[model samples]
Target: MVTDKQNISVNVVDYPYDTSVPLLDNEQFFYIRDEKRHKGRGLAAILTQPPSVQYRTLAERVKNQSKYGFPSHKLVLLIHGHQSFKNALYQPLLADKLSQEGYYVLRIDFRGLGDSEDCWDPKLGRTIKQDVEDLTTIYEFVSSEACKLLLGRTLTLDTIVAHSRGVISMFEFAREVYVPNLINCCGRFDSHGLLLKAARRSPTWEADGGFYCHTLRFGEWQDVWIPKAETLSAGTLDSSKFKEIDSGTWVLSVYTATDPIIPITAAAGYSNLFAGRHTLNIVPNCDHNFYGLPDDPNKLNLSLRKGKVNYGVYLVKELVEYLKEENQLERFYKTHQLIKSAKNEGDVRNRWCLPYEFSQISNFRDVGGYTTGSGTQVRPGIMYRCANPNEATAGALDYMKSDLSVNKIFDLRATNEAIEGGIIPEFDVENLSFNNNMTLSPEEMAKHYQGMFLSSYNFPQAYEIVLENSLPTIRHIFEYVLDGNVDEKHAIVFHCTAGKDRTGILGMLILGIAGVDVDTISHDYELTTLGLCTEKRLIAKINGRGDKFYTILGPKGREIAAAYGVTPTEMAANVLSSKYEAMRLFIDSFLSKFGSFDRFFYEQLKFNKIEVEKIKFHLTI
Candidate 1:
């Protein structure tokens, strides 16, 4: 019995205003656009007074009895994402749901769809950027009217709920504007992956200009062939660019347990990119569109209590609850900021630093939880990386053995460095040396430090040398991980002295191949300074003990060390430090030289295709 007549009502609620004077009493359906597009699209919006409450917003104050409604209040904006999707799909249901809960809501559609007018020319290609532009225009209008309605009182936008592809526009808008809260539902960060799949299915989509995207709509399959140019121009979802986001913008990623266009792992991928800035809320038994499962997939399983479940109501409820609670809202964002600034150190995962009572164990932390573009996350608590575990506390060693379930340790230090540092426990250790004085000698190392005191270029070049030389050793490390006996719960630790240089390069290669972004890799490498500052200082403390350490440094190195009040060894190790740039440059070289991380694994490392899957499956979920 549902018909076009079932379109959501445009009735806007009004109250006692200057009745004689004209006011925006009814929902206004008008045209809005960006600076360029004079031929704009339709925007339907309504602002209403907050629901009368008996208590003050923050509590411990007299409740307002004024008929005009509370001046300072909560407001929400709902937006549909894809140009193909209509606002009527969920706008009315959400608008009413939020309004009943004391929020003034405004929902809108992008141009060229629903009630919204088409962009002047269809040939301009409806890109996500245009949707962003349209959204920006609407927000400006809504905010202005909202401020007036609230009488200049502060309006806390609980969140702007954007669905699917609409999340792309919302994220883009927040990067530039002040978006207080954001909810991204089933958003795909890797647009290329979708296209690649499409190309595989159609075989001629990319070259022929379009592809058939068969999607389920209204319980029926439909051919939704969109142009390749339009999708490509929408831009890829590179969340690394969102690191420096607006201070006020708190992001919450919510997705159904089942997804069609985007993978279930996409949520984890976003959290990986957003790091501490994002939290996840999974809606069980629902698909990408937020529809519930009709028949339980567990109908055959009588051993477990399970049945058909729907996320339709549960999804919206979680969102509303997140907005209401400050703890849930600010959790991930605060955590992310703390880690990014290196303000936290209780756990290595908190800031990716290895805590130790002694100087040997540095940069020790799990390397899993990084995600590939396909939404697969490197399983957490599995792969750990660090500096030498030589002379590690028994308790610390026990924690790694038991908690991390680490059975293997790949030691990347040269035989000499191992002998000098003292060998780690003989059991569970593999010496995979990269710098064996093969190309760079101890004198050359001293010279490199001396030259480095003059310029900063040698730091990343040192990383390049590790990447260039440690081919077989790196292959074996992955092989250990890919071994059939290993599972997601099992972990292995890789280390070298200082863990910031050789350890960092190896860490970067592993994480990079695992699909971690450059920013995260840099962040992980930079965590070494927080964990090893004392270790670096220990070098300076050995002032008179190691005279040979200074003698190896000739003159220039000695001058740099003395100026810094440390030995030449300290000068070399401490001067390099754990820099974000060092790891970043290393990854850049990896990508440039190898073409792709996976290709480097298969072609350069000579890993079989089956082994590659084993590696990814074991490493990522």
Candidate 2:
């Protein structure tokens, strides 16, 4: 949709922010009353284009999601300033504009503002610190399982557009957690500036606890009693100590040219603070609220038009341009790319598969972005596969904990294959190992892997053994989806040591079940070797270790390795892969027996009709 000025206009639907659903006359949008009262703050939120979702139960919602393709792949979080929310402010327009740009907007209402619950305390309500806490809580909630389940699709905070005082809280949030792209508009930083502005603006300001301010709303002035000792406690927010977003974060700071409450000169030096990709854009001829009326020295005796055209649209367009930047789009899709391209350390860092130098984990990929042959795509962030979580680097562990949110791991390694780093992860794990007793001698194991060419039947026999033995466990894993608790099982990572053989077989099954074409599945399986090659390159380069690290140790190294049927190249491939033909033939053999995946689920796995329906409902688009 486009506004009169051809400004992009995005439509929004209100969905559940909290656990409860709101009453709505229009099913497209929901109106959640801001009645949540917490520690001196209240909150509410609007979910834009929440997959056109309106259902009473989680199953119904998810089924509906499969029926209606979720078109918007991006999610944006819009946080309001000091005393604002969506409606009765310019934030709705901003949210809609972002929606028009294919971003799902979660417009937040801070406590004690808009239609949200009221805060009785002055210092505690909407203070920078408290607001920062609110931001963290809201972000966590938004990126959580319940929130994703409600939307019937996975969502991440792509860009955060904050106005006025919300920017300070966002800055604090940027330090506490990752803020993808932060757009700060007319934000006041530093404690002295805010208190000085407060004192100057409020009529009944006092040095003591009792201060009357018009902050609660425009028409009413309210008294907030902060004790003399605690009066300036939260008022002094220092941005000097904040961390730089230089490490692959995008920051854009905008200010109104004529913002009376926040001087343009105050933000003039702000751009110099960031060492990363940062832009400072000042919207000309606007006030702090941008489109809202400005406090002009020239308008002493004049009355004005209510709102002709929101001069604010110009300011909001800046946000759209920033959002539309290629870097931002890459940042958005990088999460969904299962097989990452190792172009550089910077590009590697932006993706989910962290390099081996920083990642003990190998072949880590969330299996959510596979596009089915029928056109719908598997949602990202839920299904995942990686090398044993037990072998993950500290950075990789943190990534899994904070970003990937892998709560359950299914170990597909044999007892010996998973040794030191084989203990269950921090979260729950089911020790479902296949090929547990395939104890060929070292020479025989090497030959078994080395002699398996693309046309060789040994490859298919190998994976068929895996499929035959692992069917029961795999059935349990999928059936667990319908066990009534989807929250604790948000992301399920199944893996062996290299995450290639057993893990790849399972990945093929998952992709095949999701209706991704066999060709895509073959390529996805092929990525294991590429990903492991990246690991090998990293291992070779780390600490001045060169290619010799991956090659024979000496003249006898090749002879010794070869006697065990393990040359350097074959040795590396042995650990990382067999071939896609292994899975292809294994699946072809399965088809020869069971006929179809549906039949295999019924005959081999013994899933009843209802269970089969549940599997189709959960896995398919």
**Top TM-score hit:** 2
Q: What TM-score does each of the candidates earn?
A: 0.45, 0.46
- Displacement of residue 370 (Cα, Å) in model 1 is 1.9
User: Tens digits of per-residue lDDT for model 1 on 1-621?
Assistant: 111121211222332122221323323333333335435324434444344433443211112212223222446777775544333344555555555555666665566554455644555555767777776665554434334333333234446888877777788877876555788988777766656656666788768787656543322346645676666755455656666665435688987776767787778787887764677988666666665456646332322212334344566667767755234323422443222211223533532434666324655666665445565655666677776677777767777666657777778888777888766673477788985437676765665554333222236555666666778888877877777545535667777776667777777777776776555566566666655655644445444345555555565545655543454445455354664444554565676688778888888899988888777776666
Cα distance off (Å), candidate 1, residue 475: 1.6
lDDT of all predictions, in order shown? Answer: 0.58, 0.57
lDDT of 2 at 253: 84
- Ten contiguous residues with the weakest lDDT in model 1: 1-10
Q: Write the per-residue lDDT of candidate 2 for residues 1-621, one digit (tens) a residue.
A: 111121112223344343223323312332222123253324555665633334443324323433432234356778877545554345666666665554577776665664455554545545665566556655555444444445544445557888777787787878856556888887776557767765666535554443543343322335434333233544676777555542335678888776778877657556766643567887666567765354543222222335433556666666777776344544434323532222222322222555666776667666655556565655555677766556566677777768767777788877665664466456677777775445555554443443342122246555665677677777777777656333313667788766777788778777776677553465467556546655543334332433332332343444444344333444444444534434545665666677777777778878887877676557644
Top candidate when judged by lDDT against the true structure: 1
